[model samples]
Target: DSIRVGDSLTSADRPVSEPISTPPLAPPTLSCLFGANNGPLVGQEGSIVTSSKIRARLISETDNNVTLTVESCIEDAEKTLVFGRGELQLGILIEQMRREGYEIIISPPAVVTNICPDTGKKTEPYEEVVVDVDAEYSGSVIDSLTGARKGVLVEMMDDASDGKTRLLFEIPSRGLLGFHSDIATVTRGTAVVHHCYLDDREYAGALGSKLERGKLVSCELGKATLFALASIAERGTLFVEPGDMVYPGMIIGEYNKVTGGDLEVNPVRAKATTNIRTVLKEEKAYLPPPKRLTVEELIGYMNDDEIIEVTPKSVRLRKVELDSGARERAARVKKKRLQAQMQKKK
Candidate 1:
């Protein structure tokens, strides 16, 4: 196959035009970390996993699992670096890792910012979002996105073929972080959402989290009882139903927005019975359906001080420190540190 029959082989030191600018070596725009409570991954200490678009190095083997980092880098083609790109890919990676008998506490994904070379301004990657929903639900979707997510509406059109409304917008990649479930809730699970990277733009300016509510954590470990769930349901929504296993520091539900701040409660309290008979009959209690979260939704729902515990058998959400006293102390310290930083910025 080598240059047969005097056919001249076109060879050069380099390409004349550099071939489509080589895609400009995509910038690292997203990140996640190990939980603050994890220690050495059992025996896999000092191990690292990397791929074409992501790199996770076991930065520390210390028992206190804090100070973790991520970098999107192109490496071996066979490795999957897709964890930072698509939620489906991320879910797949977690599933695969858990099935391999590897369990770890992973934090929620956060967006990484960069300085725009031209304007010398802080910039973060933007995403082009397309949402198709029933015409009746379009208003709710738009209100949710524009309210606190800082999304800019680009176009709104109605699909002639399906009678659904197509809403397009440009939103910060960070804004899309855990918005899938919210959209589903608003649209009654009739919405289809998709996003793709556009380009970096001037910082959208920090915005309050649309998901600013706190979580309902368990105070004890045991199988949830209907009596305990009834009490929990009164506070807000319940994530676990009767008979589900729960542990201390594990998130059992989202606290009511009105009654904000993380609240610890018992999820396994047994119903009390007495020999005394009351004249009035106790009413039969109907338990509401538990709000089940998929892996992607769980990631979106996790707080910075929280992590998702992955295992082949279960996926659980828990605070960094399993001990309530330690977790509160850590939260206070983090709060104070953040306040100090904010003061310095001011």
Candidate 2:
């Protein structure tokens, strides 16, 4: 008689499937390197801290997810690097770690490109996208994908019976970054999109940024006040609720579509209520629900000079330089560097 031992059965010996084979590791299609979170809230909520702990967690990730690879930076041993198939795949790991009480800071996802030694041509990853949506929304979807993302529709099939359309496009891997949420919104949460690697293509011209609006930065450090949020809500969407902790350089919201500059608001300012006027006389504070950015959304929303601070309890965005004067000075230096590079190219 066969007896159960742990998850398997064995008396003398029971027949079982042969040992599973481990495939050779393949180079990642895309990769993004991330470091430990060193923000103002570091170690406040997360149990896991220190470089050794972060490295151990990342090593476990690569061991389980074969497609992922982890390496240490040659220059900085404290910094850990992760390579993966795509932004979503890597972002999933970060989200999981955060949920498990690990705090880490992530850099913006960068496409892994190659350059030909002889031809001097740059190459980047591409993906074959298959999308299905209602016929009525097809036009808008097509326009959006093709116009801004530089996607080429290879084939379109219309099913009159169901009034649905199927679209196939060969798009750059970079183009698909953060495009998922937009597709859902455009299709009213009904679009079904799938993508797979479609070989690398020659470098294309620079595509525009996904985020067109500027972020709302905090100018003070304290718990957010309802009165302050009410005034800030008119400027753009809020990311924090009343009594939420905020700090200088922390991003509180997005700017209005028409407004171009980054707005610095004091979210902790309190209202001066006169003794004579009752609380009922004050205008009702009705602030819209803050837009809680998901991992993918946060990756798409980040700028070159910004960092995403992740904790066990929350995910927040802030500038690299917290002081306003320092931030502006850094911007000037960046601009100068850009101008110098442009001149060198010329």
Candidate 3:
């Protein structure tokens, strides 16, 4: 009274919800667009546990999340750009993913611009930026936004008597890459910035004005000495103090002066002394405590020629052209190109 046909049973078939004896087959393909796992606190607390566990979760995610489409990219086999919201949203997702166990390397957020084949004009995506901050901080925000080529101010309204103000501007995506930290600092952590993409338009002139200030770089590699830091403290704010390990070209602090210049101050030098037997205890080193930069601050402070090297444990700023000789050559080439452009304009 029963017919056997391959794996299918014929009692004329069973209900859809009823159990079948055969095991399910695996899907043909699965992949993921991984993001960065930066900051010192990542792996210390979370489920999923190891990096491999994170990878497994991502692959499994593809099975359940219907919206994501994964594919291989030639730029780096280990990296994939999950094309979705801007870096901020993607960053939040990456943070959450890392909390769940995946260790991924994320590049700086860049706009994927399009070229008009007909007119050969370069285009970039724009954004609508909304800012809620104290009234006093409005000027700096306006100046910084304008400098970045953010479009006209659409509105400025006062928020309820907490002495807060709300400002809105249509900004280009390129202009907003590192703007969040600057807004926060300027408002003393009281400002909130919300932005979403607008439209793709002509490229903005440049977006580095907000990060134009120069940085204090370490001229040598060693543990920072208190004596040297005390002497160098007058030139600028200190980023590292005594006993902190520093590497050459490492950005230690920001200079106070507006005009850009690199100061060669070695923080690891030891004091020389003669063996005169004086019974006084060693003088307490009076060094100013250094400022520790957060991840947002570090990103906000880097220039176009530099990059923020992030790891699970640390964030380091380095020249995009890492080697000294290569950096110098690149600088020269850039300078020459600028000079030629200026000459052409004249």
Candidate 4:
């Protein structure tokens, strides 16, 4: 309450109210951080992918951008945590960084958890999402939110004349990660989504994993050859084309179904040159162009062992280990560790 410009108010024996100080502006807690992009192609595309350069760049980001903050990891200086408003804001930063010729590896969006001051319990962020979809897509949207995302249905209203529906949901923040792509898929690009911070609540169990099919990883490094890609394409879809540059542990394509799992194939293998010529005409192989992923999509599709290699000239996906044998060994080690943990729990 404030006094009028020309009027003065006086009180006798007034009880003083407790002083309320404005809270200092705190940095946003990172939903995920971009890890080191230390792939084989690290320095080729960007001039600033090193620890020092990345740190400098990230620190500078906070100067102009109010939605995000940067901090170095105590365990590894090469890795930095970038706290931001959400994936969309972070994705824009990644794109800008790449354009500036910085090569980096981005990690999947990490879920942020906090300690509730009052209850002394772990808390996680939640969101209020509102979606408008065509009548035909309304059911699927509801199912995805309530079933897969653990969202609470707040309200649903149908527009009979226009054949569209308005839906509201209170969903865990982590559940909304990568959901824009799914919403596009389900609604045939006819849906609109708006979300804002709701509140923090006790942490929930796992919402679920990305529903993407397994990817095709390359086993060799070189320019892909039509002779080799044609053979590999039969197993599933091809993401790389002939003459495309590929490296060991690079993701080349995706399997047709989720059950197919990951498979390693040679993207650079070429047919042996021989003196013998075929008597009959050979059919020319036609291969589809490789899939191009946006910064958000790339981050969304990446697995734990994978990272997005961002460079000014190129964007690639590669395994952390790089070598096929090393990756397999790492996978085995991880599996054993998980099994041990499970046994301990039991």
Best by lDDT: 2
Query: For every model in order, what is the number of clashing pairs?
Result: 0, 0, 0, 3
Give the least accurate 10-residue stretch of model 4, judged by summed lDDT: 1-10
Q: List the residue pairs that clash in candidate 4.
A: 30-83, 37-105, 239-290
Candidate 1, residue 339: lDDT: 100
**Model 4 lDDT tens row, 20-118:** 344444335345556656776667666776767777888877767656768777777668888886778788998998888788887767877889999
Tens digit of per-residue lDDT, candidate 3, span 1-346: 2332225543646445553575532121112244343323344434333434445555555564433334445675554545444544444445556454444544444556778787789877777889888888988888878775566688999867788888989877667666776677777888788876667678776655443556777767778887888778888898877877666666677777776755556788888878787888978667667787654455435565655544444455654443456767887999999999999999
Error of 1 at 252 (Å): 1.2
State in Å the error of residue 112, model 3. Answer: 2.6
Model 3 whole-model lDDT (C-alpha atoms): 0.62
Across 78-134, the per-residue lDDT of candidate 2 in tens digits comes to 878777877678778888889888888777767788887878899888888999999
lDDT of 2: 0.82
Candidate 1 collision pairs: none
lDDT of 1 at 252: 89
Write down the TM-score of every candidate. 0.73, 0.87, 0.68, 0.88
lDDT of candidates 1 onward, in order: 0.70, 0.82, 0.62, 0.79
Find the 10 residues in a row with the least total lDDT in model 2.
1-10
Q: In model 2, what are the clashing residue pairs, if there are any?
A: none
Q: After superposition, how far is residue 340 of candidate 2 from its true place, in Å?
A: 3.7
